[model samples]
Target chain A: MDDLSTVWLILAAAAATYLTRIGGYALITRMRTMPPRLEQALNAVPAAVLTTLWAPAFFNSGWDVRLALIVAALVSLRYPGLIMLAAGWAAAMAARHLFGL
Target chain B: MNRRDIIDGLKGGAVIALSTTPFAVLFGAVAVDNGLSIVEAGLMSATIYAGASQLVGIELFGQQVAPWLIVLSIFAVNFRHVLYSAAIARHIRGYSFWQKAVAFFFLIDPQFAESIRRAETGKPVSFAWYMAFGLIIYVSWLLFSVLGAWFGSMLGDPKVWAIDVLLPIYFLGLVIGFRRKPGFYPVVAASMVGSMAGFHLVGSPWHVSIGAICGVAVAALLPLPQKPDQSAEVTH
Candidate 1:
C-alpha cells in the first residue's frame, strides 16, 4: 500500500521473475551432457509454452476472441507475422463492430 | 556483430513490439485503474518486463494480496521462462556471463521463440541481433506502459476496439509457427486440453505451468527421434 513497500514488492517480484528467466539456463549449463529425452522435452518447450497463451483464451472467451485467433492461425499458415496480426485484428474489429459479436 | 544481423533483429523485434503495444498500454491503464500510481505501473513494466505476470501481480496488488504471495504469483506466471531459457541454452551458451545475464532478463516469450527459431534455422544467434531485438521490445514496453498509465482513465473500454484479442492472436501465431516441429500436434493438443482443464479447475498462472508440464510430459513420452548410430546409451 505504501510507496516503499510497493517498490519493494515490485523489486522482489522482479527478482523472482529473473530467477525463472535464468534458472533453466543455469541448470542446463551445469550439466556436461544432456539426455536425449530431456533434449526432446526442451525441443518441445516452444509449442508447449506458447500454446498456453492462447488455448485457454480460445476455449474460454467469446466468439469474437475465438474468431480472431482462428483467423490469425489461418493467416499464419499462408503469410508472415505482420500480415497475420493485421488479419486477426481486422477479424476481431469486424466481429465486434460490424457483426456485434 | 554483422550489420545485417542488427537490421534483421531490429526489423523482426519492431514488428513484435508494435503487436505488443496494445497490451502494454492495456496493462498500464489497468494498473492505474487498480490503484497503482503511474510511476508504480511504469516501474512494474520496467523491472518485471513480463507482460502477463506484471498484470497478475498488479491485479493481486489491487486486491491487497500479501506481498510474498504477489511475488510468488509473478514467479508462477513466469515459470515458463525457465523452460525457455533451458531450451535455448545450447544456442546462446557461447556468450559471456554478463551477456547471458542481460539476455536472460529480456527473455520474454517472443524473444525466446525468435531466438530458438533463428538457431534452428542455422543463423548465428549473435548478441548484436539478440539485444537489438530484445531492447527494441523492452524500450517500447516501458514507454507504452507509462503512456497508458498517463492516459489510463481517459481511454474507454478496450473491448470496443477489440484490443483484448490482439495478444491471444499474436501468441496463437507464434504457436502456429512451430507446427513443423516434431510432436507439435500431440504436445499442443495436450497443452490445450490441460490448460483448458486447469483454467476451469485451478485458475490463471497455475494453468500455464500445469499445461506446460503436461505438454512437456507428452513430449517426453512421445517416441524419441532415432539418431544414427550409438547415440550413447540413453542416460538420464
Candidate 2:
C-alpha cells in the first residue's frame, strides 16, 4: 500500500477499535440497570476472560512453560500479582535453561 | 483525584504494566523486522494498542495482505473489548460524554479488570483512578514499543528470555486472585474448558471470546445457595 493508504488503514482501524470500546458502554447505558442474570454473567466475565486468555497458552506450551505456570499458580496462593509474576518468570527461565527447552 | 485514589490507580497500573511491557516491546521489534518503518510501527501501536490484534496486523502486512482485510481482522480480534466495555459501563455512568470518549480509548483488559474490581468492592468508582491506571500503561507501552523498534535486533529472540511466558503467568495470577470470591472454581473451570475447546476447534483468538461467553452462560445458569442478605443487595 502507498503511504497515504497505510495512514488511512491505521486511521480506519483506530476508528473500528474505538467503536468496540465505546459501543458496549453506549448499549448498556441505554438499558440503565442490567437484569440479574446479566449481572451474574458480567460478574463471571473477568474470570472467564482471564481463563480463556491463559488456558490455551498453558496447554499448548512446552514443559518449561507448563512448569512455569505451575510455579506461578503455586506462588499466586501467597503473592497475588507482581511477586507471583516475578517468581514465575524466574522459574520459566530456569526450566528452559536447565532442561534446554 | 485524591491522593489515595492516585496511589491505588498507580499501583494497579504498575502491576499490569509489568506484564504488558514485554509484549509491547516484542511487537515493536517484530513489526520493524517484518518490513514496517519505525514511523508505521509507532502509528500502528499508538492506534491499535491491542497487542494480539496489532501483532496479527503486522503479520498480515508482512504477507502482503490487503490493508482492508488486515484492519477487519484486527477488528474481529478486538471485538471482545465491546463486552468489556459493557461489563464496566455501570461504573462510569456518571462521567460526561467527552470524559467517557477519552477514557474508552484506554479501555484495555488490565484497566477493565482493575475498574471492575474496584466497582465490586462497593466503593464509589473513581474516574480519576481509572484514568491514572490507563495512562501509565498507555505511556509506557508507547515508549517501550519505540525503544524496541529502535533496538530490537540487539534483544535477540524474545523467547530466549522467556518473554512469551509472562502473559499466561500473569493471567494465571489473576485467576488465582479470585480464589477467595464465591463461585470462583466453577466459573474458572467452565472458562478454561470452554477456552481449550475453542482453541483447538475454533482457532485464532476467537477462543477467548467464545470461552468467555460460555463461562458467563454456565455461571448464570447455576443455582446459587441462598445468602439472603448478600443476595438482597443487587450488583450491576
Candidate 3:
C-alpha cells in the first residue's frame, strides 16, 4: 500500500483491462469472419452479464432497494431513459432518509 | 466527414455519456468506502476507464489481498471483453492508428453493445461515430467520478437500502426486451434461477460473473423447435 506498490497495482490492473479488450480485437482481426453461433453468443452476453450483475444487488439490498428496483423495472418497461434516472435518484434519497441504509 | 455520419457519431456519443455516468458514481462510492481518497479515486477512474475491473480491483485492494492476485482476478472477470472487442473489429480495422487509439477509450460494455447493435442492423459503422461514442463515455465517466466522490463524502453513510432497486429494474427492462417468445422464456428463467441460486451460495462480484455464465449456458442448451412436416396438406 506504499507509493510504489500502489503504482504497481494500478499499472497491472490497467494492463490487464487493456489486454482483455485488445484480445478481442486480435481474435476478430485474425479470423476476418464472425460465425452465426458466435454472433448469437455475443448478442446474448450483455443481457446475461447485466442480469448476473443486478441479481446480487437486489438480494444484497434491504427492503427499500427491492422496492426501487421493482418501481424502476415497471416504469422502465414504458420509458427506459427517464424512469431509470428517477428510480435511481429516488432509491438513493429514500435509502438515505427512510431506514438510513 | 459527411454531415450524416458526423451527426450519427454525436448522437451515439451522447448516449454513451448517459450510460457512463451512473457507473462512475458507483465506482467513486466503492473507492471511498474502501479507504481511498477522492483524488485517488478520480485518478483511477480517469486513467483506467474500465468500470468492472476498477470495482474488482478496489474491492480486492480493501481486503489487503496481493496486488498480483487482484490483477489476475480482474483479468479473469474482464475476460469477456475479449469477445466484445472481437465483435467490434470490423468497424475499427478501417480506422487510422489515432482513430484506433481513440476507439479504445470508449470500448466499455454499453458503447460496445450499442455499436454492435448498429452493426448487426447493417448501419454504416464509421470511425468518427465510434470515436464520438468513446469520447463522450470517457468524459462523462470522469465527471461522474468527481461528483460521486464529492457526494459520497458529503452524504457520508448512504444507509438507504430500498433505493438500491434501480439497477435491478434497469436490468429487468433489458430482460423484457430480450425475450423473443415462448422459446426464450424457459431458458431465461432457468438462467435467472441458476444465477440467483449461485448468488445465495457465493457472494457479490463472483456471483455476477458466475450467474451470467449460468444464464448463457442454459439459454444455449435449450432445444430449438423442430421443423413442421414438409408434406402436410394445407388446411383452409
Candidate 4:
C-alpha cells in the first residue's frame, strides 16, 4: 500500500471538507440572500449523495446482503444509527450462518 | 466567557461525543478493512472528522477509484456542512477571523444541529461554548478511530463477522435520517436508480458522482415551497 499517497488523499479530503465548512460563510458574507433553488439544492445534498453510497450495494448484493440491508433500512426509520447498524449486522450474520443464505 | 455557557456546551457535547463513538470505531474498522493503516485511519478521523465521508472515501479507496474522484466524493458527502455554516453565520459574527476558521473545521453535523437549536432557543452561541462542545466530540472521534483500527487489524475475515454489511447499512441509516427534508424522496429515488444504472453501465466510482449529480439536479428543478413572507401576504 502506498502510505504516502493515502496520506495525501486524506489531507486533500480534509482540505475539501474544510472548504465546505467555511464556504457558506464566505458566500453569505458576500451576498445579501441566497436564491431559493440554491437552498433547496443544498438541502437535498445529504440524501442524494448518501443514497448513492448504499443503493448500488443493495441492488448488486445477494439475498443475504439484501435481507440485511432491508432490515437495516426498516430499523433506521424508527431507531437510531447504532440500533439500525446492529440490526443489520445481526441479520447478516443469521442469513450467512444460521439460515445458510 | 460565561462559565455557564461553557459548562452547558460541555454537557451537551459529551452526549454527542458518546453517541458518535460507535461511528468513529466503525470508521476505523472499515478504514483498515479497505487497506488503510491505523495511523492513516486516525489521520482521517482527526483531519476530515466527518464520519460518512471518511467511510465513503475508504470504500472508494478499496475499489482503486481515482484519487481525485475519491476526494470529490468526500467533498460531496460533506457539502451539507456548507448549509451548517451558512445557518450559523449570523450567530457567530462575534468570533474573530481565526476563531471562525477553527470553528468551521469542527462543524460536524451534531455541532451544527446543536448550535442551531441553542441559537433558536435564545441561547448565546458563544465561541467558548462552541469550542467546548466541538473539542470533546473531536477528541473522542480521533481516539476511537485509532482503537477500532487496531482491533480491525487483528480480525481474520471480515465476511465471517458480516463486517462488509456495515457500511451500506450505515449509509442507509444516514439517508433515512434526512427523510423529512424537502424533495428527499424524489432526490433519493433518483440517486438510487441513477447509481444502480450507472453501476451497470459506467462502473464503480463514476456511479457515485453521476448518481449524486442526478439527485441534486432533481432538487434544483423541483418546485419551490412558498416563502414565509410570501405566504403571510397571501393569508393576510
Candidate 5:
C-alpha cells in the first residue's frame, strides 16, 4: 500500500480503538446505575482480561517460556510488583542460557 | 490540580511508566523490524497508544493484510477498553464532554487499573490526576518508540536479553494483585480456558474478548459471599 493508504489505515484503527475506549462510558453515563450482577462482572474484568491476554501465549510457547512464566507467576503471587517482573525475566534468561533453549 | 494530587498522580504514573518503558522500547524496535517506517510506528503508538493492538497491527501490516481487516482486528483486540470505560464512567460522571473525550483517549490498561483502584478506595478522581497519568505514559511511550525505531538494530534482539518475557510477567503481577477478591479464581480460570480455546478455535485477538466475556459470565453467575467493600484494599 501507499504511504497515504497506510496513514489512513492507522487512522482508521486509531478511530476504532478510541471508539471502544469512549463508547462504554457514553452508554453507561445515560443509565441511572449499573445492576449488581453487572457490577460484579465489571469488577472481575481486570483479572479476566489480563489472564486472557497471558494464557494463550503461556500455553502455546516452548518450555523455556513456560518455566519463565511459572517463575513469574510464583513471584507475582508473593511480590506483586516490578520486582516480581524482574525476577521472572531473570529466571527466563537464566533458563535460556543454562539449558541452551 | 492541588500539589498533593499532582505529586500522587505523578507517583502513580511513574510506577507504571517504569514497568511499561521496556515494552514500549521493544515495540518500537519490533515495529521497525516488521518494516514500518519510524514515523509510521511513532504515529501508531501516539494514536493507538495500545501496545498489544499496535503489535498486532504491525504483524498484520507485514503480512499485507487488508486495511479494513487490520482495523477490525485492532478493534476486537481492544474491546476490553469498553469494559474499562464503563467501570470508570461512574467516577468521572461530572466531567464535561470535552474533558471526558480527552480522558477516554488516554484510557489505556494501566491508567484504567490505577484510576479504578483509586476510585474504589474513595479517593477523589480529578481530571488532573487522570490527565497526568495519561500524559506521562503518552510522552514516555512516544519518546521510547522513536528511540527504539532509530537505535533498534543497535539494541539487538529483545529475546536475547529476555525483554520479551517482561510483559507477560507484568500482567501476571497485575492479576495476582487482585487474587484476594471473591470469586477471583473462577473468573481467572474461565478467562484462561476461554482464551486458550479461542486461540485454537477462533484465532489471534478474538481470544482476548472471548476470554473476558467468559470470565464476566462466570463472575456474574457466582454468588458473592460478602459484598465487596469499596474502601477495602485487596491485599497485595
Candidate 6:
C-alpha cells in the first residue's frame, strides 16, 4: 500500500477503536445504570481474552510458549507479583533459547 | 476534592498506572515488528490507549492487510472497553467537560477495575482524582511505549529472556484478585476453557470475544448462593 493508504488505514483503525471507547462511556453516562448481564459478561471478558491471546504465544512454533505459560501460571499462582513475572519470563526465554523455540 | 482525597486518588492512579507500562512496552515492540513507524506506534499508544486494539492493529498491519479490515478487527477486539466505560460513566457524570474528556482517555481495564472497586467499598471518589489515576496511567503508557519502541529497535526481537511470561503472570494475578467470590470459579473455569477452545477452533481476536462472552454467560447463568450485602453502597 502507498503511504496515503497506510496512513488512512491507521487513521480508520484508530477512529474505530476510539469510537468504541467513547460509545461505552457515553451510553453509560446517559443510561445511569449498567445492566447486570453486561456487568457479568464484562467480568469474564479479560480472562477469556487474555487466555486466548496467550495461547498462540504459548503454542507458537512448537510448545515452548506453552511450557513457558505453564511455568508462568505456576509462578503467578504462588507469588502474584513482579518477581513472579520475571520468573515466568526468564523460564520462557531460557526454554526458547535452549530449545530454539 | 480535599487534599486527602486527591492524595488517595493519586495513590490509586499510580498503582494502576504502573501496571500499564509493561503492556505498553509489549505493544511498542509489537508495533515496530509490524513495520509501523516509531511515530505511528507512539501515537497509537498515546492517543488510542487501548492495548488490545493496538496489538490487533499491529498484527493486521504485519500481515499487510487492508486498513479497513484492520480497523474492523481492532474495533472487534476492543469492544469490551465499551463495557468498561459504561461501568465508569456514572462516577464521572458530574465532572467538568475537560475532566471527563481526560478521564475518558485514560480509562482502561485496570483503572476501571480500581475505580469500581473503590465505589463498591463506599468510597465514592471525585472525577479529578480519578483523572489523576487515568493520567498517571496514560502518561506512563506513552513513556513506556516510546521506550519500548526505542528498546525494541535496539534489541532486534522481543521474544527474548522470557519476556513473554509477563502476559500470563500479570493476567493470572489479576484473575486471582478479581475472583473473590466462590461463585466466580465456574466463570473462571468457563472463561479459561472457552479461551483455549476459541484459540484452537475459531482464531485470533474472535477467540477472545467469543470465549469471554461464553465464560461470563455460563458464570452468570449458573446458580450460586448470594450473600447479603454487607456494605450499603451504590456504584455511581
| Best candidate, DockQ | 1
- Rank by lDDT, descending? 1, 5, 4, 2, 6, 3
lDDT of 6 by residue, A5-62 (tens): 6677777776776676677667655544445545555555445444445545555534
Runs with alpha carbons beyond 4 Å of true place in candidate 3: A32-35, A88-101, B29-33, B90-93, B96-98, B150-152, B161-177, B180-187, B200-202, B222-236
Give the alpha carbon lDDT tens digit for every residue of B12-39 in model 1: 9999899889899999999999989999
Best by lDDT: 1
Q: Provide the lDDT at A53 for model 4.
A: 77
lDDT of 3 by residue, B1-236 (tens): 56676678778678557755666787788788887777878877876677767877888879968777888878766766776676577655567767666676557776776676677678767876776667767888888887887777554443433223444555565565555533356546555666688767864455656766665666555553364223212111
| Candidate 2 ranges beyond 4 A from true positions | B224-236
Q: Report every candidate's CA lDDT.
A: 0.89, 0.81, 0.66, 0.82, 0.85, 0.67
lDDT of 6 at A29: 50
- Which stretches in model 1 have alpha-carbon errors above 4 Å? B228-236
Superposed Cα deviation of residue B104, candidate 5 (Å): 0.5
Residue B49's lDDT in candidate 3: 75
Q: What does chain B score (TM) in every candidate?
A: 0.95, 0.88, 0.75, 0.71, 0.93, 0.85
TM-score of 5: 0.94
- Against the true structure, candidate 4 has what lDDT? 0.82
Docking quality level of the chain pair in candidate 4: medium
Ranking of candidates on DockQ, top first = 1, 2, 5, 4, 6, 3
- In angstroms, give how far residue A76 of model 4 lies from its true place: 3.5
TM-score of 2: 0.91
As for candidate 3, its interface RMSD to one decimal place is 8.5
Q: How many backbone clashes does every candidate have? A: 0, 0, 13, 0, 0, 5
